[model samples]
Target: MRQMRERLGTPRAAGVAGVLFALLMAAAIILVRLALPGGADGTEITVDAGQRGAVQTALELLPFAGISFLWFMGALREQAGAGEDRFVSTVFLGSGLVFVAMLFGCGAAAGTVLDDGQPPSAFGRHYAYTLLTTYGLRMAAVFVFTASTIGRRLGVWPRPLILLGYAVGLVLLVVGADMPWSELVFPGWALIVSLHILKGHRPTDHPSPTTP
Candidate 1:
């Protein structure tokens, strides 16, 4: 009974964390994008106070977003425990950790603008978004793919959710960099998945994680 209660509690925890992560990440991305609409152009630039505050707020939210994502990931992994395939679990862990690292990397890169009290060079802006849309999205794709696989294997998620995960993962993997504001898709998908989990979409009957 205790074990069952623990399992029941995990989805709620994961859902709450995921929702928080989604909100923070999306806010940060939107703020940064709005403030620095230019993608790597080294064109002459000015950093007005409003622009500076927007970016500062965005950067400040990243650490909290990353922390929430870790919590969300941990809860999902706990629910998948014993049923998880070792190789995929490793990839899942790696992708998540790298994504978080990239988040910090981006914060540092963007921070240069505020640090020097001047507009960063074209290289700095390019480097920051490159880490985000390029590397970060790829890591996100890997994480989503693995999570979908785990959910499917454990029978914890329905077919539609699995399909949605795959579609979003593909988009992130392939077209994330080309599209403007494309990073929003990750948070959007996360919000959907979290809502599904929060709704208690999983089966009530017990099935061994190692069964299939």
Candidate 2:
């Protein structure tokens, strides 16, 4: 009974964590975009007082976002229980961690711009830019892919959600960086999935483990 209760409770916890992660991450991304328009070509944008404040705010939000994401990811893995495939879990865990590391690295590099109360140099922009756009999205794509596969095979998620995950993964892998405002898609998907889980995630009823 305790095990079953814990199992049932995981969805709500994961949902809350996911929602927090999604909101914080989306806010930080939006703030960063507003603060640094034109990607690395943001000398003018950086100089603007309003944009500078936006960047500062984003920096503050990132740590909390990372923490929440870890919680969300952990709860999600917990939902899979002990019988989850080691290989799939490995990929899922690796990709999620990499994505978080990239996010933190990006935040650290971007913080340098506010150090001297001046516009960021090209050096800082390199880390802030590529870490966020280049590698981060790639890792996100991998995470999405593995997550969708596991959910589909386990019957933890519905068909439409799994399909959407694949689509989101494709977008993030292919043109996430080049496409404007595409970063928001990840958090958006997270929010949707989290809500679904919270609404009625019945893992015990899946029957996948018992099927002959």
Candidate 3:
């Protein structure tokens, strides 16, 4: 465990994970608070079934951001160790973990909101929509970042799904102008993270790292 901790980083994987988790938790808390019954005038209120689904959908999308974070972290881990597979493996592993974490969080939030009734309200639905859209932007950033990272590392390139994701992100930004254009910042982020990933490890005389 100690050895694994050392590999995580100077501050360590646990610390990094904690920070990421905290951010997610904070988002969750905000969602939960909003989901609670409240009126437009700040009085207690209730919502309908459709409103409940809308609220749940928005809140659930957020944890997906964690997926990208985890992926980068995993990449960091491999890059941390000394071996042939090194940085590339680290990136893929980290990236995969990020996605997995996102899936879990999304699932949990959805389940909680649906199964457990916490009297719905106009305030909660509105708040959830705001946060959900915010999360969509973050998820956009993650997908763009990951697609670029993988492309740069392996030169294998992004599949159609990735390109589709980028397009969707852009559309969301334009349509949801009220929200920040964090997704629009993806190209820049992709360029930066790609440089860092490339900087760390050079290609061997052989081929690049495979996904499997």
Candidate 4:
């Protein structure tokens, strides 16, 4: 922890990671929404418009997986540092990547299910919907918890953004009430963090007493 405090005393990388992760998170959400049923797929427009609500709900719920994965990368970078250890860090990175990838895959799969030009079996459609929504929410929780804990230990703490993120995530989980929006809040939080990353942190030449 002391080592990281000394390394991150400048705060540049933390800000940079925050901004970059936020952009990527936003992009992931946009991409998933574009590919979903009510999105570019036009399934909802041509067929049952009521299903558009479901599709929109699914779209909102789905992208958190990718956002979570990208945020995890920032957290991982903070831990591993800009050193030779990055190769080792990647091994740990795979889990989050896979989670996000699966969400994307599920989005594509959902689009196909909706576009089949017929009413799907209640069982199969429900199953796919469940899978898509479940993973997104799970991964979002993982990212927030991971960020709050890991960021603190790394001495960067993500400042105001992370605390607000945790609160928003908690409210979404409670008020969302099994709806997929419970997961959507995290992507916006991830987006904020990513933007902070791009802006880069302002560096201070001298370290504080706590920085070892």
Candidate 5:
């Protein structure tokens, strides 16, 4: 029974973690996007008091979001069980780790701008933005691709969800750098996957038999 509980609990825990990761990541991204200037060139990054506060809040949330993402990844792998394909799992784990690292790197770069007590240099601002929206999200795209592949192979995710995952991955890969809000797709995908897992685990009620 102890082992049974552990077996049953792990996936649920992962689902919860995935949900948390999605929420936190989305919040952080939204806050940062709101705080930053709209231009792509990053030459005019003047932060007002409100923007400063928003950016600081986003930075504070990012580390916790990264941690939760790691938990989500682990739980997902565990859900894959022992028969998971080594190549796909390797790619999944590697991409996930790289994505988190890049996320923290972006946060650190942004924090440095905040710490400098002056407007960020255009180069620094562009560097951080590129790290996040370009390279980091591309890693996330790889993660999505590999994860969806594994899910499809294992019959874990439904066809529609798998197709959506593929679409999200493609967006991240091809259009994320050019698109302003494409980063949200990652957390959105995570939310969908998490909710699906939770829904799947819900206990079903049986109808009573009629008397003869």
Candidate 6:
């Protein structure tokens, strides 16, 4: 059992957590997007049975997603070892917590609308949307930026993956609220990073020696 526990405590465990988090979060986002109408005019919206069901399903999945995300964060920190920079690590951890909090907040707000069996008041709906698309995604952007930076510095990630992270972060930071389905970038990047980590290919740590 001890050996099993030790084995599960490796960076590969973090990669697994990252993969789970990515899938759960992507599902939640897709369900929510399908359930809710687009455009900022919340007052004009109405909720049907299908939409309610979708939102409920999304809310149910969110808590699990958040928990997995926390595990992923811890695993990532463990993988960073003692060489992690304090400032960037702080940003990474802080943004991840804030993102999860905002995600829960959005879920709670949507739950309230469901409980009432009607569309939320325009203010309420807009508030929830803003929390998710604006605050939550911005925090996610920060998390991605910091994670990518740490990965690059540690030589844990390929240059192409790091570049893709930058692009995803920019989208979340600048236009996440304006763009439909932009939140998908977060999970997409997470999936790629997790897969790479799982492959156990840290270039800096395992450089090929020159054949003299």
lDDT of each: 0.87, 0.85, 0.43, 0.51, 0.83, 0.82
Residue 25 CA displacement from its true place in model 3, Å: 17
What is the C-alpha lDDT profile of model 3 across 72-170, one tens digit per residue? Answer: 455444433432244545454554454445445444544433544565334434544344345544444454544445444443333443465455546
Badly placed stretches (over 4 Å) of model 3 are 1-119, 158-162, 176-212
TM-score of each: 0.93, 0.92, 0.34, 0.56, 0.88, 0.88
lDDT of 2 by residue, 1-212 (tens): 34544665688888999999999999999998877776765545345667778889999999999999899888888877765789999999999999999999999998876755665777787778888888998999998898888888767898999999999999999997788888898899899989999897666644445446
TM-score of 6: 0.88
Best by TM-score: 1
lDDT of residue 42 for candidate 4: 33
lDDT of 1 by residue, 11-66 (tens): 98899999999999999999988888886554647767887889999999999999
Over 128-161, each residue of candidate 6 has an lDDT whose tens digit, in order, gives 7889998999999999999989888866778998
Write candidate 5's Cα lDDT for 34-112 as tens digits. Answer: 7785734755567777887888999999999999999999988876665488999999999999999999998887774
Writing each residue's lDDT as its tens digit, candidate 4 over 39-81 gives 3213343435445455555555546535645644655465435
How many clashing pairs per prediction, in order?
Answer: 0, 0, 10, 18, 0, 0
Local error of candidate 6 at 134, Å? 0.8
Candidate 5: worst 10 consecutive residues by lDDT? 202-211
The best-first sequence of candidates by lDDT reads 1, 2, 5, 6, 4, 3
In model 2, the Cα lDDT at residue 88 comes to 94
Q: Which parts of model 1 are misplaced by more than 4 Å?
A: 1-5, 42-44, 209-212
Model with the higher lDDT, candidate 2 or 3: 2
The TM-score between candidate 1 and the true structure equals: 0.93
For candidate 1, the 10 contiguous residues with the lowest summed lDDT are 203-212
Question: In candidate 6, how many Å is residue 184 off?
Answer: 0.9
